[model samples]
Target: MGIVLNQSLKNTVITYLGFGIGAINTLYLYPVFLGATYYAVTNYILSAANVIMPLFAIGMQNTLVKFYSQCKTEEERGRFLSFTVLFPFLLCIPIGIIGLFFFDDLVYFVSKKNPVVQTFIWLIPFTGLCMAYFEIFYAWARVHMHSVFGNFIKEVGLRLFSLFAIVGVYFNWISIVDFVYVTSGIYFLALIVTMLYAFKIKRPNFQFYIPANVKDILEYTFYIILSGSVANLLLDGDKLMLNQYLVIENIAYYSVATYIALVISVPSRAMHQIVYPITAKLMHENKYEELNALYKKTSINLQIVGGFVMLCIFVNISQLYEIVPKEYSGGIIVVFMIGLSKYFDLILGNNNAIIFNSKYYRTVLFLGLFLVLITIVLNRIFIPLYGIMGCAFATLLSITLYSLAKLLFVVKRMHLYPFTKETVTSLIVTAVLFLAFYFWEFPLYPLIGIALKSIILTAVYLYVNYKLVISKEINDIIDKMLLKFKLRS
Candidate 1:
């Protein structure tokens, strides 16, 4: 528990720091300097790359994690690692060939209004290839319980590189077209760094052998590919769809709103990095009791952290939009809708890790596919009528439905629930705190109003949570931090 707490705290710090830097890039620099159309191009291209990259990897990244724990010897693990490295390339060639032959058609179908998109269409395959290898290499590090470095490379390193690319574009050092290619190059560089470190830690030998267990590996990979692709679609498919149905500038507005809303998930993402492997190990040992306890604690912690983030965004959204162009202010509803959806997800806790690591994973994947189809249908129906707001509402509905299904599935199959008396208490306290701030009007200055409201919110929420004991883990962390500082003094 101590180790898990420490790792979660460390990862949370790094994750939020990365998000802080990324928020500047997305919220401030991109919209203020690049304008909406160029920003849309950047967002669309990246979203396209994310959606296509999973297909190129062919699920090897996930396969590596699942199989690494089951291997009986170092030799078997080495072969598994080697297979992960080689498999993505095999998948990439076919994708690249198809993308090359049908490049114009693809652009025409996706974004005919935005001719700039045609110039950068070639980057899709290149970026997808880089993303595929980066995930594979990062999974190699994750299997060995060295997640911090990979987290840095994936979250911070890539963002920092993109920051430089954005700066280059700002200074006219490069065209936006070159900036797109350079962003892809950064992913490849990060992949190489991950590979070097993975080798340094556990040098995988390239002696390929046909193990009897290879069949199981392939089977698991097949299932996970569907699961992974569906999950990717749920997260990234909307932007791609919007690119097709709407103007490119609208895509930029939606992307900015989505990014701001997504900041709430930083804690959930950070915790999952530590949770998945640990949950896998516990499941392997049949430690169901411990697993259930961890699940409840994780749910409470995520809710508390994620709730605060959502509150801050909801309260300060007006000020946040002030930092961007006035046209982007129309995305305020999109921010609230997506933020609510992510908040629901946070409260559900480690449901994803538990379900994915369980034997009931296939059922979960089926549910995911069903929800993806629902999301697509809703987006098609809504985007035509409501535009970006419709997309936001569709996302909110689809995600909430998907989360509920998973929650019910876990309860029925595992005889466990993430909710408790404390969870309800936390909700009540958060509501009261929000209402208190809602009624009190600060001055009209956006920055000052935001800062003042944030302070009041944080102080009141902490005081209420302390009195109510909303989370034992959070209480313990506060105590530990205070004690460490006292001791140092």
Candidate 2:
């Protein structure tokens, strides 16, 4: 635990810093500098690229992590690394040729509702290609037991670069169109830097031989590619569908609101980094009792924390929208719906980790595919009717249904559930706080009003949770903090 904590702490800080920069860029800089039209264009291109990235990489990044340590000798290791780097060419070559031949048709298809996308269609695949290889190289560094540098490049480095690029646009050094190109080129730059760092860690031997376990490798890679696509689709597919059904500017509105809702998941994301390995170990040791306790603990704890974030955001969403452009404020409902979905997912803490480690992992793949299919169908049905709000509703429905499915599957398979009486209490507390504060605003500026309301809400919320002892783990944390303060005094 100590070693893992020490190693991961810096990376975690770097990741949060990146998210901070991204939030600023999404909330203020992009909308202010580029305006709605170009912001929509850039976001659409990136979202489309992300959705297709799994296809481009063919799952080589994860494959490298899973199989790298299996090599008994340098020769085998070199061959495996070489294969991971080169395998994507098998898909890239054909895709490139197809793109070359049918470029206009492809552009026309995607840009039917949003013709602004036509000129930038090529950047989608190019950016996806850069993202794919960058991950492969990052994985290369990880396999050599040097992950911090790569993580920095992926998290902080890219965002900082974008911060500079946006600043460049502000200074009239680059056109909005040029900013898009520059952003895509940043991925290429990240790839080259990561590749160089990987080489510095342990220079590649560039062996041209197939690994002896090529059969198993290919099988695993095939499974991963399909499974990986499910996540990317769930994350970005709505934006892509919006491009087809609605005007592009709506995508920018959706993106801004979605970013606000995304903050609700931060606690869950951070906890998972620490909990994943422990969950895996418990499963390996067949400690069913402890695993079940952990399942419930994580669920309740995350519900409490994430629910707080959701409440704050939901209550202050109007103020937040005030900080952004007027056109972006129409996504108020988008924020609520998306935030609700994320809150539901938050309460199912460690459910994903358990499923990924269990024997029924493959079964969940089919379930995930089912989820992706349902998401697409819902988006197609709803986006035409609701526009950005419709897309948010589709997302909310698909994710809630998918989360319920996962919960039931885990309960049925392992006889482990993440719910307890405390879970219900946590929900009630969250609801009460939200109802109490939602209409209570300070007659002040947006920032000051938000701060005052949030501080009052946090005080009341924590007091109630402490008095009721909603979670033993949380109570202990509070006790520790208080004890330290008393000692210092």
Candidate 3:
């Protein structure tokens, strides 16, 4: 937990800063500068790329983290890493050739309903390739226990680039059309920087020979690719589906809600980047007792922190939306549904990391495929009926069902659960705050009202949780910080 806390805190700060910048871009700059149609084009292109990235990387990122810790020698580990790097080309080369031949047909099918996306169809595979290599390189860093810099690059550096590019649009230095190209370049830039950093951390010693455990390694990567694909589709699939069923501008509306909801999940995302390898190592060492302890601590701590984020979002949502354009106001319910879904996923802790790194990952992979099917079906039924709110509903249902299945699998398979008295207390406190703040708002300006309301809500929420000692881990950290403050004073 020491290393987890140390790195998790740093990663959390970096991710939050990234999301802060992203909020400005999504809510203000993209809408104001690019307009809804172009904003939708940009969002759709990225979503399509992420959907394809799993196929491009062939799940080698997960393969690297799971196998690196199990290898016995430098040569053994190096050979394994070399295979992860080389094997993706086996998958990607075919994918690229298909894209080259069916480019027009694929674009026609995808953009049949909304044609704006046709112009940027090529960007999807190009950006997906960039994202695929970026994850592989970042996984390279994670195996060496140097995830902070990679996380910072992935989280902050990319968003900063987007900030500058969108600002260029604002200043008329770049047109919206050119900014699309710039977005693809930003992803490539981040990948190059991260690849260099990974080389500096642990330079790859490329070997032509395949590892002896190639069969098992290939099996795991195969299942992991589907599981990874399912996870990403849940994150981005709704936006893509919306592109098919609705006008381009509607994606802009739904994307804003989804972006706000995703901010609640950033803590989990940041923590997982470093924790995945550690969890894999624990599994390799068969450290069940320590593993169980880590599981519970992460669940409770994330629940506490994730609850705080949701509180700030829901309580301040009205004021927050007041400042954004009125067209986006309809997504208030969208934010709530998606935010709760992500919070539910957060409370499950490192369950995904545990399952994906464990032997039972193949089982979860099939379950994930089923969940993805269900998500698409739900979106199909709901989106046509309810529009943007329907997309939110489909996502919430998918993540909720997927999360419960993962939680039960971990509990049954490992005989370990992440809930305790603290979990219940956190839920009670969160629910009470949600109720109390639902009707409360200030007569002050929107910005001042949001600040004041957030301050009051967070102060009270912290005081209650601390007094209850809902999580000894969280309380101890808070106590240590307070003691340091007192000592300095």
Model 3: per-residue Cα lDDT over 27-56, one tens digit each: 888888888888889999999899989999
lDDT of 1 by residue, 1-489 (tens): 576576567777878788888998998888876788878887777788888777888888888887788889877788878878876676677867887788778878875766778878877777777888888888888788777888887778889988988899889998876776787788779878988988887887775455567788788778877877887787889988787678889998998999999989877877787788888898889998998898899999999999898888887887768868899988999998998899998999888888888888888888888998999999999998999999999999999998999999889998778998999988887777777666554767777888988988888787778678889989888778779889533
Clashes of 3: 0
Q: Cα lDDT of model 3 overall?
A: 0.88
Ranking by lDDT: 2, 3, 1
TM-score of 1: 0.90
User: TM-score for every candidate vs. truth?
Assistant: 0.90, 0.98, 0.89
The order by descending TM-score is: 2, 1, 3
Reference-based lDDT, residue 218, model 1: 81
Clashes of 2: 0
Evaluate model 2: give its TM-score: 0.98
Best by TM-score: 2
lDDT tens digits, residue span 250-285, model 2? 989999999999999988877998899999999999
Tell me how far the alpha carbon of residue 383 in candidate 1 is from the true structure, in angstroms, after superposition.
0.6
The parts of candidate 2 lying over 4 Å away from their true place are: 1-3, 487-489
Each model's C-alpha lDDT? 0.83, 0.90, 0.88
